[model samples]
Target chain A: MNDDDRTAMKKRVQRLVYMAAGGRISEADLGRYDTDLRQIGLDSLGYLNLLEGLERTFGVAIDLDHEEDHSFLHTIDNIVRYLVAQGGEAV
Target chain B: MNGDPTRGPIQDALTDCLGRHRGRRAVVGSEALSYDELGGRIHAAAGWLRGVWLEGGAGGRAPRHVGFCLGNRPEYVILYFAVLYAGDLPLLLDANFNTGEIESIRSDCGLDALVIEPAKAARLEAPGKGDQVPFADDVVLLPLSRPGAPPFEPRPATQVCRFTSGTTGRPKCLEFSGHAVVSAARNWVLGTGMTGEDRTLCLAALSNGLAFNTSLLSSFLAGGELHFLKGAPLTRPVARRIAESGITRLVAFPTLYRNFVAPGGPDRSAMAGLKHAISAGAPLWPDVREEFRARYGLDISDYYGIAETGPCTFEREADHHSGLGRPLPGAEIRIAPGPEDPDGPEETGEVLVRTASMASGYLNHPGLFEQRLDADGFYHSGDRGRLVDGRLHLVGRTQDHINVAGRKIDPTEIVAVVSALDGVADAVAFPDEDLNREALVHLVVVAASPELTRAAVAAACRSRLASYKVPGRISFVAEIPRTGIGKPRIAVLREQLNASAGA
Candidate 1:
């Protein structure tokens, strides 16, 4: 993936996460760049919805392992890396 | 609480009352369910279910146990009654139950079918879980495999089978007779002064024992509209719902009350026609209770009841001085000493209660109900409370089970999940409160493998247990302190976590 694509993917991921947690989690509750959603008071139900949203948004099957690892979902950098690795080359 | 009007089956009463009040509104939200509309939806759902069973070549004699996972929605009420109306036992499963947990319930409770949301249905990868059959617009039904051929024995008296909350990892299914369930609702209406004119907004899940016993039956039987709030139970939404729905009674746990009263906003008018707020399944902190009273000018009624037994006590006055209310007329209570102590009934001990509305038995486990339901017919509540001036003041639980908000987390469930990982020599899970005084699972482990980490355990648990059961904090310890009989001393572990968190 190109630099522009990677950055765009990261932004889309962030937006989708926000959309999934629309009413339940607040943006202010999310912590520093590396903080996980669990640390931000996002309950398990939030993660489930986030996973579903990501799947629907990116058309990718993401699992719980990515949710737990900091290098996968806890930060934008991790999420970008995951999306790129999941063959995000098209378009 | 004392009057037993020899009520008929709840499904019958609901149908009759709904027919009588066809023009009246039953549930109001984005859309409304008039009694006539609600009855149509229930009939449609029941007809669909009956047709599915008939197509599957199921005999009319066999009444299957049908499980469903649903959130706060108008369809929940419809589907629940529809299942009963179709001669199947409505089994309410938690929406958070993972695939493995669902399978375990199927095997243990002989669950024949499961209706869950499509997204949830995708998560369940159980073998032979049939192709999704659309049960409702929001949820789908998947047939589960139950091998036990129980010779088509019908429990004519049992209306619904709800799982009870306990610290034990093994779930126990409690069967409530139609008479018992109806009586329980009528008693609450009689005891709490719930009138047909009242409008109730329930914040808790319909499957929750608190809501099932108090709100569902009492509201409908009293001819009140039971409003449901979707999404999280945060303060603003709850306040907004109360205002919009003109909710006179707000049924929820204590933590929500704390959040609502924390801010200096929301006057009596903000809650629209709200007259009363009910809190149960956990203790209402004194300061929070006092703050609510001072700000809202309304007393928070504290309710006390057991899952096995029906409504036990209720305190109408907010300033009961932390005292629980007296028992209802028919419901009897005995405060006996702990099993270890040789105390008499006069002294404060375990709260043993026997009511006409007590559960018939644990349908899942053959002999388990007998163990809790004493020979004298009183089910031991496992809670320690003292009756003072004819009012009950709860001391605490005799066991160290963690009650997080209203959800009970079995420490053993956590231990089992964590220990299932590849390299943990020993592990202990306990409940600890954060600065907010809300409960979180805290775990300590003696890792034999250097590769084992908190993230690994949490990830594994996410796949196995519900997210709430996952540990908020995990630490490596040398060894867990235990009693001579090999019981882990959880209180010491709680103290250690408190000290470390403070640092």
Candidate 2:
């Protein structure tokens, strides 16, 4: 993915995180793409909702059982990188 | 064989059930375990537990308290039965409980040992912490040294204990007798029409009353297969499991049902094998229920059960679309008259439940459970509901606790945690919905200083409380409206917040 595409993807992933947050984390606080989502109140339930949102929106099916490393879901930047690696393009 | 002199009724019943279905699959997690294999494992685990108790110098004083702080897995099942077989009381604690709650449980009710995951056992740094013995692959038996006696004791007949959210970090432990538990399982099996062919896919935490009453012992009693998902209950994985395992029954909370009806959810074919969909913990939204039925062709049976009284009622008929179904067998529901309709039979008041599967009492708080009971043995459920054509329809709760998803969180606990965090001033927590309409704890804080940010308050709460107990929404206010007696005027506060948001 190009830099511009990655930036757009990061924005989309951040939006998904904010939506999944369900007001648990402020939208402004979610601006930092590298900040750990859990540290900003993205709990287990939030992660579940985020996973569903990611799959529905980006078509990236993250099978947690198969993925040995869960850090891909820790931050927006990581999520965008993982999504791009899985062939998910900027919509 | 009539009964074993050494074993309790629960253990005896379980042994009989397992022996009858020796060749059948009992439980499936990462792998499947046959009834015969499960029985043998339970027998061996019980023997090992007895040895542990003897080594701990509590030999003659059988029935030590063993806390289960793990998730829904086969090891949890095997060890739970083994605890009972070894003549010990098993306390099923929410696996999400933090170290503070675990310590409080240890101090309030003496825990001889805790069956917990190794990762948690590694982080648990307590004063009376003892040696950790490996039990299963990822599970361990961490013994705790009880200094002197605990503040409270369980009743002699109390065989198992489960907890409800309590104020100030101490979860109220409800003790149940062996007979009560066995009766609950048997009634659930009989009422739900479960059979040996039924494969139950339980998604709720086994510590929760919904899964505990419906799936745990009842599956074995009916000689059925109990299945547990390895990871989170995501829609795709759950649907895949249902399709692959031929799961006949799905016991989950309302949030999951809502997800099933959401856009991009799994197709109806994924849930083709499911015959019964049981939803509990909190009220299922009407729209979600209808949408789920329209999409999946399955009517979600919204189950009504209480922590004090086991499984109260279940909808038996597939076509019954009305109130929470008629009371299950061994259960009776009586609606006391409210002031509006004193002479009518259909009066709506507190739901009074008298069930053979009722809990004995609260082990921690003495007489707290009895305080709610009336002249009859019926326990006041605190829920306002009227019986309509023999079906129980709930109106609302008389209590102040907030129901987030399926877990009942005491708002006072959240308020206490936030208020203590150099939080300047007043705070009140109440139930509110998020963008997705999921239930969440809304904490409104009145900060004394301008320096206190939302991040600070949220950070304090995240560190001190359980993940579920943390408030999903935090708003700062100048002052909180209170009644003359210091009760929060939640309706007024909600109006003010809404007006400001619209401004």
Candidate 3:
């Protein structure tokens, strides 16, 4: 993916995170891209919901093999980088 | 008398099931594993476990309490049998629990070893050396060592253990005997009229009671095809599953039903194969129940149970009576005067239950379980219900446990954790209905300083409690309303919380 596509994809991911946190988290919160999602309001379940949203938005199978596998996929920056590496592109 | 149905070790049942029921489907979801295949896998895993435990190493002693940090996979079932087959207690841990919750549980039960997924184990950073072993194609096992944890011996006859909310502090692990575990599954199958032809679609995680007793072993023992849903339980996905697998029995919690009969409900013909659907844990709204019946031509039967005591009541379609239904066989339910009565309580008594499937006691705290039980053998279920003309109707619970999205959140437990924070001067928690009419945990606290904002409280709770247990809404209150006995007035406290939210 090009730099513009990657930036768009990251924006979409942050949008999904905002949706999952019920608007308690906003774009301003994503200024610190490495902010722990758990501390804000996107909890473990919220993270799962965010994954489901990403899978739908990106048309990619970002789901883990098992629910426990999501243990390593928590902060916003980690997930964005992982998605980009996994070939997810923004339309 | 070999399949006597009520008495036997679950481990022995798997042994008896080996290779005998070949060609009969055991699991039918991600991949079809017949009894022959499942039985072989169980034996193989057990053999590997025994080899590892018996091998020479520091602290060669075996672990009595072992935790299963597994997910909703077929290998989870295999490891469960393998753990029990080796005469060890398998503690089912939800993969969704956080690092802090996991550490608290390890300390509570004095767990010697935990078989967790590699990713989760890494996240836990659990003490002791970690070794990776193959569990299934995609899942690997990480055996966690609690090197310096105290050694614990379970109560006599303890067979299976799972954690439930405690009155204070971390959650307590409840232990069940071999006979109790087997009887729970057996009675469910018998009482529900499950047959080999029945293809059940399990919708909940295996760690929960609804899925464990009502769907998992119960389906296997009855020679039924156990199917796991591939996708979410929303209307479209669930309808597709029903059409594809011809799921005869649907065992899911109530929210799924609410979603099914909501505005954009599933097509009527798609649910044609569903013979009977059951909901456990919290009541099903009458409108949802009626709409499901109207649209699908089936009643959403409700099952009432307590985590401490298993399978207290099953709603049978008898006499057109519709309250929590009748108690299951081998269950003794007592209704006595509540120690502290609820305002406008429908039932004038509290429910006490004793069943063959009841847990032996809490593994960590001895005599803690008995404190809930009176002079009689019955455990005082925190619920308030009434029995009239042989039907039990539940009004409410005296405890402040909140049920949000199928998880039990203890208000007292949160209060203890939040109050211990430096800037917090007393904290109170209660459940309130969100805009969607779902339960949400709300916290009202007297902060030592105004600088302790909502974000600050959220950060503290996120560090300490499980994700689900964190308060959805936090507010600052002047003081907690209390009665003459110094107990927080719940009605007034709820009003304060509601007012703060409104503001």
Candidate 4:
């Protein structure tokens, strides 16, 4: 994906995470970048729902096997990488 | 020869009452079946079963294990008693268990024959290579609508298998003799203050030990009536029946109680006949218990028992702080010192019991059974508890203790505190090891509101518990994960968490 598309995807993923989590994510922290939901005080269940929401929002099927490796899901940079590799398979 | 010495303790109690008070009421669904009529049905079922068993066998041999997967109905009551009277063992399989779970349990327990509802029977999967049964046709379809027969004398030395809840792993078979039934009946009567006048609402399945002891045997032996609900997700009609039938007591889990005690819900005010309510399967959350008690004007009795030993300790007329109440008669409890404290009975330890109704061992797993059964035959219940002020206090499961970071946190303790929080309906703490640092991840069901924040929940936990005991992270949910019986299914919650992470 191009830079503009990647930026939009990242913003959408973060929004989806907040929405699934009942908007518990602070508004001030919305635009700011975070590696993973865990760093933003989201629990495992939170991180999971974040992934689910992102998948549903982006219409992509996440590769959960690789997602288990923290390198894939720990930070926003890693997660966007994982999503790119997912190649936009619909949920 | 009337050889069934293991006959249920309540059999003679009912029979003797039947002889003097034949006009007394019993139950067949909503209908008030007189004692004589119920006795007649038991007799008839016994006679029909005897004939069927003899026909199926070469030399009058009764089937060792007959599987029953019928819903809660009058027929199940008849069949269960008939199986006991016929001196044949009946395997009570879960009606709601998935096809795979059902087949796995049936095969693992080595069911010789099974009786299932026609619809459920059709849903059975075809046998695989490892499957011993040649065909689905190998299972005999017992006529559920068959009439009662003459009560026949049972042959002796009979045993039946009831599967454990499989909370830890694949369900294990716990064997119970006729004597266990008898002992359990006597204990139920003494423990619950059951009399001939008390009418019981049979909410729990007859298969589980709690239902069998508290409802079936307790009612039969006490000369009280047994009212069984027809289907699951008990509807308004069922609730109306419970009130209309004048059910004096209901022995159920928390989930069912939540349904009955919902906001402006049932005609609970009409249920004036209800004298007491009993809860088991899992620890009754204080809110649910208080709600039930206040609505019904009855003290909620919290019972603690396992398939290994039937009806060990119960909260009979107990205050909220008594833990699980004292041990029932013919039951002895001891707190086995944990590795943390191997000396005297401190605050908490593994709760073990020696009971007249204790199972001999787990079926086919002698070593597993032996590990639980100690030198003097005390069953080593993996549950941790404390002996406090001559009363037993259950802490939590030994296996369920999650090592969050470096500190061990009992999910039960977290649950108790979290459940009491405002807008927090329920909570389950599960182990989450991320990057080799194990911590507890809490799934919390909160009331739908913008104010229900994870930070608020964290603050509540901080105020209620120690620093190390607080959850590492919290996720808001609409409802907590639950098992078929309404207990907080911790494993299911963990699975849902994992699936969430994967997505």
Model 3, B1-503: lDDT tens digits are 13231123887765665545678888876888999888887777767777766642212244356677765767778888876665556888766677666667777666656777666666676666467776666466666666565544566577688876554446677888778888888888777778888898888778877788887677888888888765445556667788888888898877678767765557789999898788886667888888888899888888787777778777767334377777787788889886587564555688899887888888877888889987878988888888876778888887778986677888987888888887898788888754335567888899988777777888888777777787876768889999899888879988766687698
Best by lDDT: 2
* Candidate 2 clash pair list: none
- Chain A TM-scores of each predicted structure, in the order given, are 0.69, 0.93, 0.75, 0.74
lDDT at residue B264 of model 3 (Cα atoms): 53
**Candidate whose DockQ is highest:** 2
Candidate 4's displacement at residue B197, Å, is 0.7
- Runs with alpha carbons beyond 4 Å of true place in candidate 1: A1-41, A44-91, B1-8, B55-59, B145-156, B165-169, B339-346, B495-503
What is the per-residue lDDT of model 2 for residues B1-503, given as tens digits with 9 covering 90 to 100? 12332377798799899889989999999999999999999988988987876653324564688999998899999999988877778999999998888888888888989999888888987787888899988899999998879999888788899999899988999999889999999999998899999999999999999999999999999999999998779899999999999999999988788888999999999999899999999889999999999999999997789989999998888888989999999999998766754554457788999999999999899999999888999998888888888899998877778998788899989988887877459999999999878889999999988899998888888888988898999999999999999999999999999999999
State which docking tier applies to candidate 2. medium
Using Cα atoms with residue i matched to residue i, what is each candidate's TM-score against the true structure? Answer: 0.82, 0.96, 0.84, 0.62
Clashing pairs in 3: none
Task: Put down candidate 4 lDDT per residue, B164-253, tens digits, no spaces.
Answer: 544322355666666776788788789768898887887777777778778876677777888876533232444566678777887776
Off by over 4 Å in 3: A1-39, A43-91, B1-8, B18-20, B54-64, B148-151, B167-169, B230-233, B318-321, B342-347, B500-503
**Number of clashing pairs per prediction, in order:** 0, 0, 0, 19
